[model samples]
Target: MNKYGRQSGPRYSASTNSAKAPATQQCQKCLEFGHYTYECKAERVYKARPTRTQQLKKPLKRVEVEVPEEFLPKREGLAAKILKDKEAERKKNKDKKKKRSRRRYSTACTHMQAELRYFIAVVVQQWKQQEQQEQQRIFTQLLFRILALSLRLSFSFAFALLLEVVVRIPFSLLLEISVALSLVQKQEQKCEQR
Candidate 1:
């Protein structure tokens, strides 16, 4: 059995064309309850219904009338008044332009001042860099001069030590001192090269 086809209950047969029961008001024609005035079996009164007014798609054309010159509105001084207003506006615009020029000059001066500060900063930075390079060069020269002086002193001292060993000490000790001096000189040379 299909559930949607029919339910297991009593069926109802409703008529779409059947008239509905009237309201519980007495009819004006028959003075009866549950009946409308129009459905009464009496002389039917015919009353005219108010009809709706239709609006025109296009409006009616306007009629033009000729107006006399002296009786019409005056426009004699309109151009003069407009010219005066325009002159006043032009004066105001001129004043505004002068103010704008002054403002532009002030802003330009401020921009130039900023650029000048930046230029001075760059110059100072370059000067510092040059000074640092010069200091580094002077230090390197001083270090080289000191290294050469130390090598000369070491050679003269080794010669003096070798002479003292040969004159007052053993030959074996002299040989050891000479060998150590040669090694020291070679190491100093390497350091100088670096």
Candidate 2:
């Protein structure tokens, strides 16, 4: 590793034995030892240049552009009138919104009163309807009770009449036995006459 650009053999060299010898660093590629990657010649060998045909054949595209007013004639009176009318309309709309909010504030008491009246009306209507319905339910229950009592009384009366008819039937049977014995004695006297 001297300034003559030649490397020494792998064995320890007598030239490097002297401590005054300059230290040598190694290159990874081509196995040369002069420089590192920042000064690599092999990297500069592959740098590409664009061809003339690639530069000449490129296409052009349209771009949108806005022209200033100074580049054209300006409308003076008509544009001013239009701007004024637009401003007036905006002011009118703003006033209308302010008036609406003011009216809302002014009538807040009346609105509350109306809401209270509506709530009371609804509550009273519901209460009245509930009372009517309850009255109807109670009337229906009373009617059912009266009908049930009449039915029970009629059934009991029918049972009592049936019992009375059963009791009278025994006396009728005794009358029938006495009449049948007299008829049989009359028939025997007629037979003896014959």
Pick by TM-score: which candidate is best? Answer: 1
Q: How much is 180 displaced in model 1, in angstroms?
A: 69
Candidate 2 lDDT (Cα, 0 to 1): 0.48
* lDDT of each residue in 4-102, candidate 2, tens digit only: 877865444766443332226445543445565433466333436567786567744659698987996766688899999999999999999989976
Q: Write the per-residue lDDT of candidate 1 for residues 20-51, one digit (tens) a residue.
A: 44577677865667766655776655666444
Off by over 4 Å in 2: 1-85, 94-98, 101-109, 112-115, 118-130, 134-194
Candidate 1 weakest ten by summed lDDT: 143-152
Clashing pairs for model 2 are none
> Model-by-model lDDT, in order?
0.53, 0.48
Output the number of the lDDT-best candidate. 1
Error of 1 at 82 (Å): 2.7
